[model samples]
Target: MKLESHQFIRYFEPEQAAQISQIAIIKKFNPREIIFEEGDDSDSLFLVLEGEVEVSKRSGEGNNYVVITSVKSNGYLGELGIIDRKPRSARVVTSQQTVLAKIYYESITEILANTKGDIVLQILSFLSQRLRTVTTDYVNQLAYKEKMTLIGEMVNTIIHDFRSPFTGIQLSSSMLKELYPDQESQEWCDLISMQVQRMLNMAEEVLAFSQGDTTLYCQLIDIAKLLQNFAKLNQVYIDFASVELIVSVEEGLIINADENKINRALQNLLSNAVEALDQSEGKIEIRARRKDQLVEITFSDNGPGIPQEIQDKLFEAFVSYGKQGGIGLGTAIVKTIIDAHDGKIFFESSPSTGTTFYLHFPIAKID
Candidate 1:
């Protein structure tokens, strides 16, 4: 019964199992490559020879794939499908570079017809245990989602209620800045005004993101068009300054998201990039492309890059570096907006290489 590493063949004659290996096809898959999808015709049963796979199942009622379990090296897939000659029951996607030994249904049937009854019982037992594991995973995932939803609602309520006080403070600081006549006192008022405005922005961003699905007006928005417009609108600024801006989004690349929110998040990033290069001339490149089932957008800057002081807390609210009158909420807000869309945001930067931020959003599911 110890099946790991093709050792299960002890149940049958070694010569027979070894003969089957000759006809067994070995296939390789790269990271994120889908081996098969649910409902696809199943012609073969696969045995993972190396690496790992994320096994998920899709129900007819839902548009998303619910993770069932992970199958590692030596695990078999589509056994039930092979036995019944039915469609694939689940999807198998590679978590990394992987190799699989595929035995066609024709080969399996031929071997089974000649094998003893115990062989069939062994296969049935393997599948039965796998079914139990998948059932448990689905139940646990549903419970986890429910708990997360409740926590999200509580956070949203708290953040939304904070907006009023932040707004009042923002207004009071603005009035104080105007009323103070002395240069030093006026500067202090300006600092308070800036901080208040930053907090207000943070509160608004948190509130907006916390609203979850309702906050996003999902539509098939063109990614290229958005970046083009962004560059066109900021053309004057780039032209007047001693800096260069490059936009390189592929035409027709689109995603499902809230257009206004995405545009705002990106604008804030660009503005921050420009302001960071205020003293020294720099270049910023915006690039986008299709990466698997997501569109990956990169914003790169050839300035001094993120300073060591604020690099760690760059995405945290209220963390700023040498920039005068900085709120440090821009990147934080950007992250919040992306997270609300079920997208991702990460960056890499150093003094020599500058900085680059990557944003990835799932492709729109066509109904």
Candidate 2:
């Protein structure tokens, strides 16, 4: 990462650099060393000659700083103060053993005073680029906030309007099941009920996770019955004739968790499994077991598997791989809900076998 002064000071004439070198203050830094802090009026601009430094700003919260970006070798530093003698607004700390060449404000002022000076022009270019970047970021952030607010309001309206129709559909499906004489018609009614329930689960997940309405009412969950119900529910949305969905949840396995949230997390995994399957051939297997003080639930699918491009950031928000029309919130919400329950989630995937997601939850002891 060692960089020569010429690379960074290319905007300057050879004579100008020779003049600045006469008053240059070269400083070496160790890892985690601070170059300058916020509000410091030391009045020095720096050129990074080696290593990397993290640039961060003081957060709105008291006594916290958030990282903004990194400055590597050949990059200019403290350009925000090159023109006017303003106090440092951002903190700069060395991320590794570093070396910086510092030029005092007095020297820059001397250069700026020169009628044929290139220093002022270079500083102006730096300032304008910075201003443009900041403005763009601010606009993007504001737009994102606005979009999320609109979506939240829309979800609220949809939730209120959706429940009545869903309830009516459930009720009508129940009535139709009893009245329908043909077995095929009865199965269709059951399918309707299952699809409606899936929609309800998805809507609830969106409200609770996306809208940040996290109010978990924990209850003792029967694992075996839940698995049986999962199998029944999954059969409705997927092509059972082509995909083999096998679930073996041992009986008597119990846990205390938010039933709705945990169910939502598990349903996400099942949905992912179904989606991963090829149209004509795929297999999904679910296994739940208790060992020592932890319960393990695994969902594995035999499909093309997760794309290599997304394996590292698999659970990061909005990082979808190759799924068509995917918003990419499924795994992120799954991780969030599992973390809330004091559980851990991870996955192993490759082109060799399909993808397998593992969920580990602490076993709750019943006195």
Question: Local distance difference test, per candidate?
Answer: 0.75, 0.77
Model 2: runs farther than 4 Å from truth? 1-147, 177-198
lDDT by residue (1-367, candidate 2, tens digit) is 3323445455566676677777777889999898989899858778888889987777567856656667788876787676667898778999999889898888876765762546666657766786677556556545544555566677668878898999999999999988986999998898888778778777767767655556778888888887887777667455654688888887778887887688788887777777777767778899999977888999999877899888888886566764577777789889988888889999988877989999988887788
lDDT assessment of candidate 2: 0.77
Q: TM-scores of all models? A: 0.50, 0.60
In model 1, state the lDDT of residue 243: 73
Cα error of candidate 1 at position 67, Å? 2.3
User: Residue 247's C-alpha lDDT in candidate 2?
Assistant: 87
Clashes by residue pair, model 2: none
Best by TM-score: 2
Give a tens-digit lDDT track for model 1, residues 1-367: 1233463344456766876777788888998899998888999888888889998877447666666778887677887776678888789899888888887888877887888788778866777887787789878766644654564576567657876786787688778777877888776666665555545544455445433333667789999888886676567667776679988877768798977678778877787777777535688999999999999999998766888877777876556753688645578778888887889999887878878999999987776
Reference-based lDDT, residue 156, model 2:
69
Can you tell me which runs of candidate 1 are displaced by over 4 Å?
1-4, 7-11, 59-63, 180-367
Worst 10 residues of 1 by lDDT: 1-10
Q: Which of the numbered candidates is closest to the native, going by highest lDDT?
A: 2
